[model samples]
Target chain A: MKIGIIGAGAVGSILARELNKLPENEFQLTVMARTARNGFTVLEDGIKIFHDIPVHDILSVKDTFDVLFIATKTPALLTLKETIKNMTHGNSEIIYALNGVGYDDMFVQGIPSVVYVSGQQHDEYIEHFVNQKIILPDQSFTYLDRLIQIIENDESIHFDLVKDKHFEQVRYEKLLINVGINSVTALSKNTAKIFEDDSMVRLTRTLLKESIDIVNKNSQTVYISPDFIDYAMEMYMSYPREMGTSMYYDVMANRTTEYQYIQGFVYNLKTDDHPPTPVLDTVVTLLSGYEKL
Target chain B: MKIGIIGAGAVGSILARELNKLPENEFQLTVMARTARNGFTVLEDGIKIFHDIPVHDILSVKDTFDVLFIATKTPALLTLKETIKNMTHGNSEIIYALNGVGYDDMFVQGIPSVVYVSGQQHDEYIEHFVNQKIILPDQSFTYLDRLIQIIENDESIHFDLVKDKHFEQVRYEKLLINVGINSVTALSKNTAKIFEDDSMVRLTRTLLKESIDIVNKNSQTVYISPDFIDYAMEMYMSYPREMGTSMYYDVMANRTTEYQYIQGFVYNLKTDDHPPTPVLDTVVTLLSGYEKL
Candidate 1:
C-alpha cells in the first residue's frame, strides 16, 4: 500500500513511523506537514525512532497513493480537501483520525469517512494517549483486518477497526469524555486533580449530563446506554494519568482553541431544553476576548 | 488609612495607583505583590501616571489601614486572608472588588464586605478601560459616601454605589456579563469581535438567561428582565473598542484564569431547572486543561 498521511501532526507522524516498521515491506508511507519537517519521527516509551520518510507539501505535492489519511483537525478539513483535489490523481482511500463526528460533511462528495482515534500531540512528538482505533463505516471489515495486520505486525502501534453502529456509540462516548475532560480542564487550568476535588465533581457531572442530552437530541439513535457512565469511567481510569487533551494544549500555547468545533459546535445546536452551558459560555467568552487582545 | 493590595494584578495594581493620588497626609498606600514592581502605574488614554507606592511581602507587612482593598481573585483569597490576618490589626474595613457575589458568606468573620463597579481592568500597565463607577451595597451607603468624597476629590476616578436592592441586582447582572464574556472569549480565542458574530450573541444570551435563572433561584427579587440583552449590548458598546477583560489577558499570558470564581461559581449554584450551562462548562474545561499542560 502506498500511504499518504495528510497531516504531519502527532498522529500522522506516529502512523508514518509505525507503518515504516512493517517487516514485509508491503507498505510505503509519505507524510504531509504544514511546513517541511526533517522527517517522520515517533517517541514511544522513551525510544525515538526516525523514518527517513518524504515530507510533501500539501500545495506543491503531486502524487496518488493507495491510501490517504486526512489526519488534520476538522477546521482544517476544507483546506485538506482543496489540497487533495489539487494534489492527488487516481483513486485513494482517505482515513480521518480526528475527534468529533460529521467527517463526511467535511470531505469531498464521494469519499468514504473512516473514523479514527489517536490523541494529543507535543511538537513533533506524538503520544498515543488512548487506544489506537480506526473504523470504516460501510462494513469494510476485511480491509480493516488487513490494515490492522499491517499495523499490529509492529509491537509499537496498537490499532483496530470495527465497522458497526457500536463504532458511532464509541465516538459519541468519546465526545462525552471530551466534554467532561477537555472544556472543564481547559477552563479550570488544573489537571485531572481538579476532578479529585469534591466541590468540582458536581460541575463536572453537570457538563457531562448536558453533553449526554445534546448528543441524545442530535443522534437519531441513542448512543448513550445505561452503562455509558461506567463505560466513560473505565476509559477515564485507563487514560494516561498525566495527559492533557489537545484542547488543553491549545490554550496553554495561547493559540486559539477548537471551541467552534468542539463545545462551540454543541452550543450552536438548537435543543429542546435550554441546557445550562454556563461553563462553555464563560470559557468561549474569555478565549474570544483573549484573541481580540 | 494605610491601604494594602494583596495581589498586585490588573485590578490591584490600578487600584493602588489610583488610591495613591489621595493626599499623602491622609492615605499611605502599600501594595503587596507576589513579586516587587517598582512605582505602581496605570496608563489610560495615553496618560501615564506614576505613584510612589511601596510594595511589601505578604507576611512581612506590619501596618493596617482603616480600609483594606482586597482585589486579588477569589481563589487566592484564602492566601490573602492568611497574610492579612498575620499583617493587619482588627477593625480593617476590607473592600473586595470582585466579579461574582457572596463575599459575605465566605468572609472569615467580622470582615466588612465591599463590592465595586469598576467593570474592566486592562493589565498591570493600563487601567480604567471604561469609566470608574464603583458600587457598594445599599446598606453601606455611609461608607460609600465617604469613599466617594475622597475619590471624586481627585477629579480622575469616577465612583458610584448601588442604591437600594439594585446593588445585589447589579452584582448579579455583572456576573451575567462576566459569565457571558470572560471564559468564552478565552476559550474561543476570539475577540470582542466575536460578540459581533451571531453565534456568539446566541451563546451569550443563553448564558445570561441561565445565569439569571440561577441568580433568581437564590434571590427572590432577581429575575431576567426584558432589558438584560439591552444592558449587555449597551455595556459592550460602552467598552473601549480594543478593551478585553482581565481574564483574557491572564489566559494570553498563560497564567491561570479566574474561572473557579466567576463562571464556575455561577454554574455551581443550586437551581430548580438545572439550566444548561454548556458554554461555561466547555470554557472552564479548556482553561483548566491549559493549566495542566
Candidate 2:
C-alpha cells in the first residue's frame, strides 16, 4: 500500500515508524517536509526506530497514495490544504488525528472522507491517549478496517473501529475537558496538578459543564451525556500528576494558542444559544488577555 | 497647631514629619499605632528625620489635636471604626491622606468631619506623585486651614487646600488608577513596564474604561477624560521601569491585598448598578485563583 503523511510532526513521525512494521503492508511511505530535518527517529521503551521514508517537498510531491493521514496541528490544516492536494490525484482514505472537532468540513477540495481520532504529540512520536476510536458518518468503516488490519498485523500498535457517534460523543467530551483544563492551565500558568485542588475541581467542572452545554446546542442531538462527563472526569484523574494540557504548553512556551478556535469560538457561540456560560466567558477573556504574552 | 495621625504607614509617616516641621506653629504631633513603632521617620535627600511623636492604642486614644489625619489602608479602616469614639474625643479636626474615595461616610460616625488626600505611599513616607492637595467638605477644614497654614509656612512641603471636589475628584481618580495599575501588576506578576506593549496598553485601557464606567454609574459622575487616560498612561510609563505596584508587593509578600476594596468592591457595586463589568469580573476571578495558589 502506498501511504503519505503531510506533517512530519510527532504524530506523523509516530505513524511513519509504527505502520512500517507490517509485512502484509508493502508501504511506500511519503512524508511532506517544510523544514529540513537531518533524520526522522522515534524512541519507544528506549528503542530508537528510524524511518528512511521518502520525505519530499510539496513541489516534489508526485505520487498518489492509497491512504493519506494529516497529523499536523489544527491551524495548519487550512494552510496545508492546497499543498495536500498536490500529493494525491485520486480517492485516498485520509485519517485526521487532531485535537479539536470540526475538521471534516474545513477541507472542501478534492479529498476523500476523513476519520478523527484523539492522539498526543511528543517530541519524536505521537502517543495514543485514548483506547476507543470514532469514525464519523459518510465515511466507510471498511477503509478504517483495512487501515486497522494493516496496523494490527503487527503486535506493536493497537487498533479499533468505534461507532461514529462514539467518536462525536468523545470529541465533544474532550472539548469540555480541553476548555476547562487547557484554559485554567494557561491562565493560572499552573499544571494539571493544581486542578486536583477542590476549588480548581469546582471551577473546572463549572467550565466543563458550560462547554458541554455549548456542544449540546451546536450538535443535532445533545451528545454530551452523563457517561461522557464521567469519562472526561476519569481521564483527568488519570493524568500524570504534573501533566498539563496543550494550552498550558503554549503558555509555558510563550506562543499564541488555539484559544481563538477553542474557548473564544465557544464564547461567541454562547450568544446565539443564549446559554448562561459565564465560566467560559470569564476564561475566554482571561486567556485572551494572556495570548499576546 | 496640633495634628494626630492614625495608621503610621508611609503616608502617615511623611505627613507627620512634614507637618511637625512647622516651627512658628509649634505643632504637637501624636501618631496612633497598632503596635508601638519607633515613631515617624522621613528619609529625604539623604537626611533621615525622626519625630518622637506620642503613640497611643486606639482604645486609649484621647486628648484630641487641632487636626487629625487617617492614613490607614482600607482593610484597617473597619477596625478603626470600633475605636472611633475614643479616637475623636474633644475638638479635633480629621484629615484622611489615604488612597481611595468616600472615607467620610466611613469615618464620620465618631467624628463629625475629616479631611482627605490622594497620593502614592512611598517607603515610610508619602511621595506626592501628582501635585495637588484636596480637602473634603467638612466643618473641620476651618481647623484644617490652620494646619494647612502651618504646612505652607515651610517652603519645603508644597501644598494648599484646593476646592473639595478637586480632592474628591482625585480620590476616585486614584481609586480608578489603582483599579487599573495595581490589579494588573499583581495578577500578571510583572512590573508596570509591561503596559508599554501595545497589547498590554490596549488591555489596560479597556480595564480602565470599564472601571471608570462602573465608578461613574455607582458612586459619582466621574469621567476618565482622554487627558486623564493619557495622564495614567504617562504615570505607568514613568514608573521606575522595573517597579511593580504596591499590590504586587502584597502578592509577592504572600499577604492579602486591598482587592476587596478595589476590584471586589467594584464587582459588587456593578451588581447593584445593573451594569456588567466582565473585564473587572475576570480580573477579580483570576486574582481569586491566584490567591488560592
Candidate 3:
C-alpha cells in the first residue's frame, strides 16, 4: 500500500521516522511539504536523530495514494482538505493526527483519530518530548487493513494507530488534557516547568474542572470523571520540566494557535442547561486577543 | 519646607519635573535613586522634555525631610520601609503615590494618596501618557498644609494632591481600573492597543465585574456601580495605542510586578459573603506563575 503524509512538522516528522520502520517493499511512503526537502532531524534528550525520508512538494504530486495521513497544525488542516480529497481515491483511509478537534467534519471520508504524539519543531530540528501513541475508533476500513497487516508483521514502529472500542471516552479525555496543559502553557508562554509552581497546578485543575463540566453536559460525547483532573495534573508533573507544548511553541514562535478548536470548541458546545464557564470564557477571550495581536 | 522623593522611576521622575514647576527656593526638593543621576528625559508625543532635576544616591542620603513622597513601584515600596522611615522626622508627612492599594498601614504617618499620573520609563527616558491628578483623603495634616500652601502659591505643578470629600470611592475606582487594565496588559505583554479589540474590551469588563463584586461585599468600602465597567472600557479606548501600563512595562523588562498589591489585594479582600471570582482567581494564578518564572 502506498502511504502519504502531508506535513513534515514535529508530529509529521516523527510520524515519517516511525513509519520507516515498516518493510520497504510493502509500504511506499511519501512525505509532503510545501517545498521538497531532504529530511528532518529530531532531538530527544539533547541527542539528534535524523530521518532521511523522501519528501515531495504538495504542488507536484502526480500519483494517488491508498492511505494518507493528514498531519498538520489545526490552523493548516482545513486549507488542505480539498488537496487531501484530490490525492485519495474511494478506498483511501485518511487519519487526522492534529492537536485540536473539530476539523474532521471538513472531509467526507475523514477518520478522526486521537493523536497522543507530542513534540516541538524548531529551525532545522524537531524536539521529541512525549509518548508516541495514536488511537483510532473501532470501525471498518478498506485499504488500511493492508497497511496494518504490514505494520503488524514487523511491528517495529510503536507509533502506529490501532482500533479502540472505547474511543469516545478516550477522545474526551485527550481533549480535557489539552484543555488543561495547552491553555496554561500557551498563555503562560512557559514550558512544563510551570507545573512546578503549586499555584500553577491549582490553576490547571480549575481549568480542567471547567472543561469537565462542559463535557459532562454534552450527551453526544462521553462524560469524563472529576478524578481525571487529579490524574491529568499527575501527568503534567511527569513531563520533562523544560519541555514546551505545541501551543506554547506556537505562541513563542508567533504562529497561529489551536486554541479555537480545543478550548473554543468545548466553549461553543455549552447549552443553556450547562453551567457557565467563566474561566474558560475569559481564557478564550484572551487567546482570541492574542491571535488578533 | 524640606521635600524628598524616594524613587526615580517613571512616576518619581515625573513628580520631580512637575514639582520643578514650583519656585525652586521655597521647596527644597531631592530625588533619590540607587546611584546619583544627572537628570531624566520624558518623551511625550515623540517630543523630548528634559528635566534637569538633580538625583541623589539613596545610600548617601543625609537630610531628614519635613515631607516625603514615596513614588516607587509597588514591589519596591515594602523593602524601603526602613530607609523611608529614617528619611522622615516624627512630624514628617509621608505620601505614597503608588499604582496599587494596601501599602499605607506599614507606617504610622503613612498617608495613602490616589495618583493619576501614568508613564513608562525606557532605557534613559520616561513616556508620560495620562493625567497627573492626585486625590488625597479628607484628613488633616500638620506639615502637609504648608506644602499645599506652597503649591497653592505658584499653582504651576498640575500633579499636586488635593483633599477629596469621598476618597474611598476614588480609591476603589482606581483599584478596579488597575484590576482590569494592568492585569490584561501585563499578561498579554501588549499595551492599551489591546482595547481596540472588542473581545479584549469584553474580557476587561468581565474582570472589572468580578472585582466590583468583591468590593461591594466589603462593608468597609463603598459599592461601585456595575456601570463603571462600561465607563472603564470607554476610558481604555482613549489611551494612546502604543502606551503601556506600569505593570506591563515591569513584565516586559522582567522586573517584579505590582500584581500582589493590585489583583492580589482584591483577591485577599474576599469574604464569605462574596461570590466566587473564578476569572480573577485564574488570572491571579497566571500572574503568580509569571512572577515565579
Candidate 4:
C-alpha cells in the first residue's frame, strides 16, 4: 500500500510515525508538507523519538497514493484544496483527521475521523501528551478495511470503527469537548487544573451546554445531552494538571488557532429558535480579540 | 485643619499630593502609609511631577487628625482597621475614598466618596491618565465642607458634593463601571482597545447589563437602565488604546487584584430572584485562577 499524508503538523507527524511502524514491505509512506523538511521528530514520555519518513513539498509530489490522510488544520484546508484534488486518484481514500464539523461535504469521498490525540510541536520535535483511539466511520470502503487492519494490528495506536449512521454524534461529541476545554484553557492560560475550581467547572459546563444545543439544533442525526457537560468536565480533569490544549499553545505562541473551525463554527450556527449562547458568544468574541492582538 | 490619608497606593498618593496643594498655614496634610518612604511622584501628561508630602508609617503615627481619608484598596482595609481606630479623634470625620460598596459600616462615622480617577504606578512614579471630579455626600458635615472647599479651590482636582440621599446611586454606578471594565481588561490582558471589537463590545455590554440587574435588585433607590450598557461601552472606548485598568496592571504584575471588592461584591449579591450572571461568574473565577498563578 502506498500512503500519503499532507501537512507535517503535530497530527500529521504523529500519524506518519505511527503508520510508518507498519512493515515497510507492505506500506510505502510519504508526507507531502508545505516545506521540504527532512524528517519529523516527536517526544513520547519525555523521551525523544525520531522518524526519517520522506517528506516532499506538495507541489513536488507528482505520484498518487492509494490512501491519503488530510491531517492539516481546518483553516488550512481551503488553501490545500487544489493540491488535495491534484494528489488524489480514483482509488485514493481521503481521510480527514481535522477538527470541527460539517466540512465532510468539502471532499468528494472524504471520511472524517475523530482524532483522540494531543501533541505540541517545538522547533525540532512534537510533544505527545495523550494518545488514544481514533473513531472512524464503519463502512464498506475497501481502503478503510485495509487501513483499520493496519492500525488495529499495530501495538502503538488504537482505532475504533463506528457505524456510519452514528458517526456524526461521535464527531460532535469530540467537537464539544474541544470547544469547552480548549477555549477556557486558552483564555485562562491554565491547563486541566482550571476545571478543578467549582466556578471554572460551572462556566465550562455552561459553554458545553451551549455548544451541545447548537449541535443538536443543527444536526438531525446527532443529539447531545446536557449530561455531556459533566462528562466533558470529568474528561478534562482526567488529563494532567499541566496539560495545555493546542489552542492554548497557539495563543501563547502568538499564532492563529483553529477557533474559526471550532468556536467560530458554533457561533456561525446561531438561529432564531436556538437559545442565546451568551457564554459561547463571549468566549468567541474574546478569542477573536486575542487573534487580532 | 489637620488632615491624614491612609494607604500610599495610586489613589492614596494622588489624594495626598492634591490635598498638600492646600494653603500651608490653613491645613496640615500627612499621609499614613504602610512604608515610611521619602515621598511620592506621579506622571502627568508625560511630565514628571514630584510631591514631597509628609509620609509616616501607619503603626508609628501617633497624631490624631481632624479629617481622615481612607484611600487604601478594599483588600487593605481589614489590615488597617486597628490603625484607623487609633488615628481618628473624637471629632474626626472619616472619608472613605475607596472602591466597592457596603463598607461604610467598617467606620463608625464614615463618608463614602465616588472617585472618578485612573492611574498606574511604576517603580518610581505613577502615571495619571484621567483625573475627573469626585462625587461626595452633599451633607453639611464640617470636614467634608472643608475638604470640598480645599478641593474646589485647587486648580488641578475637582469635587462634586452630591446629595447624601442619592450618593449610593452614583457610588454603585462607579462600582459597576469598575466591575465591567476592570474584570474584562484584566482577563483579556488587553487595554481599552479590546472593547473596540464589536464582539468584545457585545460581551462587555452583556456583562455590564448583568451587573446592573444585580445592582437594581439589591438597591431599591437606584435603578440602572439598560442604556447604561451603551454609556459604559462609550466610556471604555473613549479611553486611550493602551489604557490599562488597575486590575489589569495588578494581574500583569502578578499581584492580588481588588476583584473581591469589585466582581466579588456583585457575585455575592446574587439571590434566587436575580438573573444568572454567568459572564461575571466566569471572569471572577478566571481572576481567582490568575491570583493563584
Candidate 5:
C-alpha cells in the first residue's frame, strides 16, 4: 500500500521510521520534506539512529496515496487542506496524530489518534524518549485494518498501534493533559520537572480544574470527571523529568505554539452559564500575546 | 556626616560610589555587605570601573549614621527593622530608594524616593545604563537639605538628586510604570524589546489600564488620570529595548521578584466595587507560583 506522511516532526518521524520497517510490498512510505535533507535522525537511548526514507517536497507531490497521516503541528495542519487532496484519492483514509482536538470536522474520512508517541524535535535531532504508540478508533475501517495488520505482523516494529473503542474519552483526557502540562511547561519554560515544585503543581492543577469545570459543565459532549485532574497529574509525573512537551519546545525555540487548538479549543467553548475561567483566560491572553497576529 | 547604604545591588552600588566621591570631611559612606568583598565593579560604557568601599555586615552595624539610605530590594527591605535601629538615631533621616508603594508604614521617618536610577546587576558586574537621579519626597526634612547641598556642590558627581515638589505624582507614575512593564517583562521573561511587538504593547497596556482603573476607582487618596496610560506606554518606549527590568532580571536569575510589592501591592487593594482583574489575577498567580511560599 502506498502511504504518505506530511510532517517531519517528532510523531511524523517516528511513524515514518516504524512503518519503513515493514516489507516493501506491503508499505511504500514517503515523507514530504521541504528541507534539503533526504534522511532524518532520532536520538534514542543515548544513541543516534538515522533513517533513510524517500523525502519529497510536499508541494511538489503529484502522486496519490492509499493512506495519509496528518502529523503536522496543529497550527500548520490547516495548510494541508488543498495539498492533501493532491496526495490522496477519494477513498484514501487520513489518520491524524495531533495533540489538540475538534479539528476532525476538516476531513470526513479522517481518524484522530491519541498520538501515544512522545518526543521533541530539536533543531538538529529528534529525541524519542517514550512510547511509540498511536491509538486509533476501535471501529473497523479498511485502511486502518490494513495498517494495523502490517504493524502487528512485524515483530521488529517497536510500536503499539492501539485500536481502542474509547478513543473519544482518551482523546479528551489527552486534551486535559495538554491543557495542564503544556500551559505550565510553556509559560514557565520548564520541563516536566516543574511539577516537582508544589506551587507549580497547585497552579497547574487550578488551570486543569478550570478547564475541567468548563468541559463537565454540560453533558452535551466531551465530559471529563473531576477525578481526571489526579489522573492527569499522575500522567505528568510519569513523564521523564527532562522531557518537554511540544508547546514547551515550541516556545523555547521562539516559534508559535499549539495553544490555539489545545487551550484555545477549550476556552473558546465558553458560555454564559460556564464558570469563570480566570486562569484559562489569562493563560489564553498571554499565549495570544506571545503569538503574533 | 555619616551615611549607611544597606544594599549592594544596582541602586545601592550606584549610591555608594556617588556618595563616596564626596569629600571625606563632608560625607562618610559605608556599604553593608554580608558577602566577603570590599569592592564592587560597575561596568559603565563597556569598561569595568572598580569602586572600593568599606563593606560591613548589616548585623555588625554598631555605628549610627546621621542619614541612612535603604537601597535594598523590596522583599529584603523589611528585614532590616532591628539592624536599622543600630544604624540610625532618633534624628537620623531614612531615605528609601525602592520601587512599588505603601511601604512607608514600615518606617516612621522613611522618605520614599521616586528613584530615577537605571542599571542592572549582573553576576559580578553592575551595568549602569542611564540616569542616576534619586527623587526624594518633596517635603521639608533636616538631612534632606544637607544631602542635596552636598550633591549640588560637587561637579564630579554625575547623579541628579532631584527633590521634586510633585514627588507624589511621579511616585505613583513610577508604580503604574512598574505595574505595566515589570509584570509583562517578568512574566514574559523578556526585556523592554517586547514592547516592539504590538501584542506585547497591547498586553502591557491592558495591565496598566486595569491598574489605573483600580487606583482611580475611589479617589479618596492616590488618583492617577487615564492619560497616564499613554505616559506609561511612552516611558516603556523610551527605555532601551535591551535593558531588562528589575523583575525581569530577578526571574532570569532564578531569584524571587518584586511582584509582591509591585503587582501584589496593586492587586491586594481590590474592593467590592473594583473592576474584575482577570489579567492581574493571572499574572499574580503565575508570579506567586514562580515565587516560593
Candidate 6:
C-alpha cells in the first residue's frame, strides 16, 4: 500500500517517522511537505533521531496514494486545498489528524482523527513533549484496516480504533482539554505550572465545563462528565513545569496560532440557548488581538 | 505648611517636583524614598526634566509633618508602616495617592486620593505618558484647604475636589478603569493597541461592565452608567499604540505587580449575591502566579 502524509509539521513528521519504521515491502511511505527538504529530524532528550523518509513538496507531488493523512493545521488547509485535490484519487481515504472538529465535511469523504500528541518543530528538528496515542472512529471505510495495520505495526506509536458510538465524546474531551490548556497558557505566557495556582485551576475547570457544556448540548450522543473538568486540570498540572502549548509558542514566536480551530472553534459553537462563556470569549479576543500584532 | 511625601516613586517624585515649585516660605516639602537618591529625573519626549528635591530614606526619616502623602505602591506599605507612623503627628493628615480602593481605613486617618496620572520609570528618569488631574474628596480635615491650595498652585498638575458624598464612587470608577486596562494589557503582554481589535474591545467593555456592576451594587451612593463601559474602552484605545500600563511593564520585567490591590481588591469584595467575575478572578490568579515566579 502506498501511503502519503501531507503537511510535514510536528504531527506530520512524527507520523511519517513512525510509519517509516513499518515493513517497507507492505507500506511505501512518503511525506508531502511545504518545504523542499527531503527529510526531517526529531530530538528526544539530548539525542537526535533523524528520519530519512522521502519527502516532496506538496505542489510537486503528482502520484495518487492509497492512503493520505492531512496533518497540517486548519489554517493551512486553504493553501493545500488544490494540492490535496490533485493528489487524492477516487479510492484514496483522507484522514485529518489535527486539533479541531467539524472539519471532516470540509474535504471529500474525510475522516477526522483526534491526535493525542504534542510537539514543536524548530527548523528541521522536532521536539516532542507528549506522544500518547491517536484515536480514530471505527467506521466503515474501504482502507481502514490497512491504515490501522500500518500504524499499529510501529511500536513507538499508539493507535486506538474507538467505536463510532463514542467517537464524538472522545473527540470533544480532547477539544475541551485543548481549549482550556491552550487558551490559558498562551495568554498567560506561562507553562503548565500556571495550573498549580488555585484560581487558575478554578478558571481552567470553568473553561472546560463551558466547552463540555457546548459539546454535550450540540451532540446528543456524547455526554461529557462534569468531573472531567477536574481530570483535565490534574492532567495539565502533571506535565512538566515548562511545557508550553503550541499556541503559547506561536504567540511567543509571533506566528499565527491554531486558535481559530481551538478557542475560536468553541466560540463559534455558541448559540442563543448555550450559556455564555466569558472566559473563552476573552481568550479568543486576546488571542485574535495578539495575532493582529 | 510642612509636608512630607512618603514612598518616592513616580507619583511621589512627581508630587515632590510639583510641590517644590510652590513658594518656599509657605510650604516646605521633603520626599522619603526607598533609595537614598536625593532627587529623580523625569524625561518627557527625550528631554531630561530633573527634579532636585530633598530626599530621605524612609527608615531614617525623623521629622513629623503637618500633612503627608503616601505614594508608593501597595506592596511597599508593609516596609514603610513604621516610618509612616513616626512621621505623622496627631494632627497630621495622611493621603494615600495610589491605585486600588478601600485602603483608606487601613492607615490611621488615611485619605485615599484617586491619582489619574500615568508614567513609567527607567532608572532615574521617569517617562510621563498621561498626567491627568488628581481627584480628592472635599471633606473636613485640618489641612485640606492648604493641601488643595498648594496643589492648585502648580500649573503643570491638575487637582479636583469632588463632593465628599460621592468619593467612593469616583475612586471606584478609577479602580474599574485600572481593573480592565491593566489586567488585559498585562496578561496579553500587548499595549493599548490591543483594544483596536473588535473582540478585544468587546472583552474590555465586558470587563468594565462587570466591574461597574460590582461597584454599583456595593455602593448605593455611586451609580456608574452602563455607557461608562464605552467611555472607558474609548479612553484606553485612545492611548498611544505602543503605550503599556505599569502592570504590563511589571509583568514584562518580572517585577511584583499591583494586582493584589487592583483585581485582588475587587475579588475580595465578591459576595454570595454578586455576579461571578471570572475575568477578574483569572487575572488576579495569573498575576499572583507570575509573582510567585
Q: Which candidate leads the pack in DockQ? A: 3
Measured by TM-score, how close is model 4 to the native structure?
0.80
DockQ of 2: 0.12
A1-293, model 6: which lDDT tens digit per residue?
78889877788877787777768787788788776685788887677877777678777778888788888877787677777878778888888888876567767757788887688878658897767466778677777676676566656655443335577778888888889888888777778888777778887877787787777777767788888987887889889888888887776675778888888887887888777877777777777766666
What is model 5's DockQ versus the real complex? 0.25
Question: DockQ for the candidate 6 complex?
Answer: 0.40
> What lDDT does each candidate get?
0.61, 0.61, 0.82, 0.79, 0.80, 0.77
Error of 1 at B144 (Å): 8.1
Q: Could you tell which candidate, 1 or 2, scores higher by DockQ?
A: 1
Clashing pairs in 4: none
CA deviation > 4 Å runs, candidate 2: A40-62, A109-138, A141-144, A158-165, A226-231, A268-273, A286-293, B1-282, B288-293
Please give me the total number of clashing residue pairs in predicted model 3: 0
How large is the interface RMSD of each prediction? Answer: 5.4, 4.3, 1.6, 1.7, 3.5, 1.7
The residue pairs in collision within model 6 are none
Model 3 residue A68 CA deviation in Å = 2.9
| Tens digits of lDDT, candidate 3, A1-293 | 78899899877888889887877767888899888988888998789977788778997897688888878888887687778878998778888887677776777777888887777777888887777777888887887766666666665776666878998788888988898898888777678888998888878887889889888877475978789998999999998788778887887776888999999988887897777777788788778766664
* Per-residue C-alpha lDDT of model 2 across residues B1-293, encoded as one tens digit per residue: 66677876655655565565566446777777686766655455466666676556655666656666777776677777656545564555555555544445664422322223333455565443333354555344556666656566668765455335454465667777787887667655567667666656766777777777776676755555656777787878887656667677666565667777677766666746566555676667656655454
For model 6 the local lDDT of residue A151 reads 61
lDDT of 1 by residue, A13-112 (tens): 6656656565547766677878776676566666766667777776766777666777776668765677776554445556666665555654442243
Ranking by TM-score: 3, 4, 6, 1, 5, 2
What is the total number of backbone clashes in candidate 6?
0
The candidate that achieves the highest lDDT relative to the unseen native structure: 3
Between candidates 2 and 5, which one is better according to DockQ?
A: 5
Alpha-carbon runs more than 4 Å astray in model 3: A34-37, A54-64, A82-90, A155-158, A190-203, B34-36, B54-57, B60-63, B188-203, B240-243, B252-254
